[model samples]
Target: MTDHESAGTPPGTEPAPAADGSPAGPAGRFLARIALGARHLAAGLRHILTTGHQSDEEIRRTLVLRQLEAHDAVRDTAREELDAVRRRITRLELAGAEEGWTPEQRQQVRMLREERRRREAAARDMGRVPFVPVQPTADQIRRARHKGSTVRLLGLLAFLAALSWLLVQRPALLAPAALAALIWLWWSGGHPPVLAQRPVPDRLLARPELDPDAAPAALTAAPGQDDDQDQDTDLRHVTTADEATARIAAALAKRKVHVRSVAPAVRTAYGWQADLTLREGTVADVVAVLRRLDTDFRVGTGRTLAEGSTDDSAIVTLRVLTSDPFANPPAPPVRPPLSCSILDPVSDIVSLDGEPTPLYLAGTSVLAVAVMGGGKSSLVRDLADYVTACRDAVAVDIDPTGRGLGPLRRAALRTAYTPEAAEAELRRLLAEARRRTADLGETEDVWQVTPTTPAIVAFLDEYAQLTPEGKGLAIEVLRIARKARISLVVCTQDATADVMGDAVADVFPIRVLMPCRKADIGVTLWPSAVSEGWTAHHLTPGDDHAPHDAGRCFIWAPGHKRPILRYVPHIAPHDALQRAQERLDAGLPTLTATDGPQAAQAAAQPIVAVMLDAFAAAGAEELTVAELLDALAAVDPGHWTQWDTRPDRLAMGGREIKRALKDAGLPPVPTVRSKLPGRPSAYRLQDLKSALDETG
Candidate 1:
């Protein structure tokens, strides 16, 4: 066989046999095969290691504590293992010699040991060892210490660098930094430590057997421990505050604590605290003492065992402060519910404050204001009660059909049905009003007109019913609304529109609306002020806002109706009634519901019978002035005398009388008609004697 180096064939091809022409034998071929197998095994191991395909056991072996030693440490460990193996081999040889071993056995043992040693040495060189940090030489350490000193000096210079720049800018910043440095030096450097450093022990710190009362030892080897054979821990040393401070100083000294100064013990609201300053000794030394102290004896705030605390030697707080004595609890918050209500009516019984402003209806600024409901009749009934409360306050009602004003007719200052009768009655009322106005002009103050002579409130219902001379009585209402002593509240469903009439525009300063479906009416009455963004949509009618009822009305007086002012509460119902009734029951001419005289039985029978029959036949929940107008607006708008100024109501008695006369076979009861002014055309049935002979 020829060596590959001397062979001159191509580079990668195998060499031919030598001139001896001997083929490569089995032993060499077997060795070549073994070498190839080893190369393949090495390639497989490389793939596993690089790609992390190695088994868990392989990784564990690679990263174990033995493999994780520092680089030099691992080398030293390898060398030591080699030495041990060498020693073992030597021992094995001695044992073999003592046993008289054969040469073949000895050779085999030596070969096996040599192979194992080579494998271990190879593993050591192949990057199996962890890296160890290089240790600096003594001179290098000295150079590092000098560099550290330079860094510290540079730090001090850096602080001055800011001041120097500031000095360059203004030349004023140096004085303060210099002064501060001087103060720091004086405070830290000049102060003598109260206790000096002494030797301490770890065992003594862990479970300290301290003798604060013991006498000073001649020389304390382990100064923090009381180790003399006869000496014991002095438990009495820290009994008083002063003694406690001294003991603390001694404990600190044993740990070589260097503080600037020690402050006297101070008392707090809860307990006592001691302020301490450490100077010469480092933070590491003081940390040992801090950990050794009682668990309950916590460090104060800002107190860290950091070396050189002159930079920020703030005191640490151990406990929290108590809460303030004056702090108030939070109040619960909730939203107000939405609501509205009609607060103004004669019998509404509610005042401006939503309290009762009862039986008396007087001094209402809303002259000719209208209400439309069955409930308003209750309010009108109370008007009689109000008139009784104020003697001079007269109520004039014209219930033509005996529906509304008829019940309280007797209490009216003047009651009339037909337009002619109403005109006559109103002439009387106006004469009284003109007289009262003249008297009021003479009075010093308007309110001083006396309780018996309070302002009068004339309430009128179904305002469109009265039409005299085709001009309509709404015009007459305007005159009374302006000139009469009493105020007017004229009620009708559709009166909110042109029906309200411009004639009374100057008189009615206050308008109280009950609910209505008409959005325009609410906006007209409210005019969107004092409602805080009052939308027409928010004005729902009725007493749904009964809770927030009082402020619902839009008050519109000259000086009193400013937008900024909140609505005042209304007077309640029952209280207003009592005040009115008291005046009337005192015989002060206060009008009352009961003050009216009951009509004769026959007359009442006709009214009650007609009312019940109309209600039953019509089946109306409630009759309204607007619905009645619509009912009559279709009818002869002119001949609606039952709704207007027609005196045919004598027809009831007249019809009965004429029928009786005819049934008895007598001449028809003579019909004599009055050509009364401002009245409907109608004939009246009179007695035969009177009709036949005026001479008699």
Candidate 2:
């Protein structure tokens, strides 16, 4: 009792005796250990069947394998996307080359292609370096250390259990067990646990850098280095003269135009020039097939030219410009000649073939037709510069808008800024021409222009703005002025019948057609000129609102039997002004007897004076605009009659009168209710007198 109490055992509870009624001994303990082992094994089996539990090593290995599989799938998807993009770029390039693309579209495609290339380079980099090393996180390291310790403890326990069982059962087997245990210990000590080793972020195997020899040719070459080589290759493949002729024949044959014989093509700075004798079609048929020829030759639009020969309509001259002929225009003359003769050519223009073509402005009328911003003003300024340089020429500018000839005003003999004043100036010139013709007296068919008797070159800008009567006067001057050494240079936006009457338009032998409407080309030149590759209508404007072919034109002159593309050298405004000032300083010649200050003064009389004279002729204190216009016409038949009786629908005689009065600094005409039937807006004589007095 005393011992049990000291050991802290309950007095009633004690160990049961073994089956032999004896105290539990070593054999009984061993049997109990076996039973405990059996129970533990059964519990493990239950856990396996119910939850499918896995060891940490198996879980980690499975995670690593899944991660590797996912990485491969992502790489494959990226490759597929890159391939799709490459295919799309290829399609766009092929489509663009087959058809045509605008500059903006081409630029967009180029940018897309560049982006695709950059992405492909990134994909290639990823492909080269298949994997990346990843540092383990703190939690991962802790788990790995715990797993390593557990595995070492399990190995030690298994070795001890095997050694004990072998020594008890068979002593001879103990040697083998000890040897196996030593090997296991050595392997466990040398190698790290599976979870403890550093993880590979990507694949285990990585490829090396691509070999230069195995790389694509485009990738191997340096940027822009291949362009020269490609250009050389293209030069080697340039179309020969015979090849060009054959291509031309093939191109024309598709359009049902037969070529009988072709001359050997002559290589020019641009591309080629050849003469062809047609068997079944005229030159128009050849021109009609230019688009097809451009495709066959791998050139751009408006690059081929075809026109009939002067002597033989059956023979056609074909020209093809491989590159843009007008990409770089020739520089204008920095300094024009200070003194020249009217008999000689005024200026030299460059043709498409890079040859200098002379423009003769002495005895013929020139009509320059262009749309707005088509470089018509530049043409006028060029002419003004030429005339200003002439020693035996006096330029008379009639610009209704007043801005066309503003820069060369100092060089002009007399400038008219209004339709009325222009009409008056033209009338005075007509009188002078008649006097000169009478003085000739059949001695000479043409007047001899000299420094003393200078030729008169009338520059009329915006001819469409002129009244019908003014236009009629201009035509009359054009008809009789050439014999008297007088020439007209008319510039207008269009040459439609309504804009420039066919009667006057036909008389202009030298026609310059700039970029304009398709119909304008036909109206400005002969009907056949449009069919002869006179492609002024195809010219378009650039982003700056100026024509792409600004100074380029198709000129139809008497010397040029067929239309030819020519570029008029632009004359800067400052240069024109400087030249004109120099000519003025040198004392330019004046017109004959009829072009002195008196005639100019009469022609340029103030509007207020004219209005006052009209008021006086009406013999009334106040008169309506219509009445004033009628009176003004009666007072000055040459200047004011055109306003009242202009045949066009733009006949605004009353409005013109009102503007004239207002322009003279007179108050607005008030509507007066008189005893007459219609109470119309009228101007008073008192107001005109006051304005005239104030101006004086």
Best candidate, lDDT-wise? Answer: 2
Q: Write the per-residue lDDT of candidate 2 for residues 642-696, one digit (tens) a residue.
A: 6444554123776676677676555664445445676656667666545544444
RMSD of candidates 1 onward, in order: 40.8, 28.6
The CA root-mean-square deviation of candidate 1, after full C-alpha superposition on the true structure, stands at: 40.8
**Candidates' TM-scores?**
0.28, 0.52
lDDT score for residue 45 of model 1: 36
Question: What does candidate 1's lDDT look like per residue over 1-696, in tens digits?
Answer: 222222212345432444565426765544444443333344343343232243332222223323224444756676667656545554554454334457875675567466645855575465343232233445554454455456655775797797678878976766886677555434432232222123343433321112222122112224334432223212222345564455445444444444455555444332334556644323334433443332213332111112223354432212111111112212111111111011123333332222432222344444222233213443444444444333355556654444644444544554556544444333333433443444444543333333344445555565555443212333333344343335555555553323443223334555443323333343234322212211212222334333221133223343333211112223234544454344434443332211112111212333222222222223343333232232322222343334334344344434543454445344443443334443422322124323323321
Candidate 1, overall lDDT? 0.38
Local accuracy by lDDT, each model = 0.38, 0.64
- For model 1 the TM-score comes to 0.28
Poorly placed runs, candidate 1 (over 4 Å): 1-375, 378-384, 405-410, 418-420, 435-455, 468-484, 517-696
Against the hidden true structure, what lDDT does model 2 obtain? 0.64
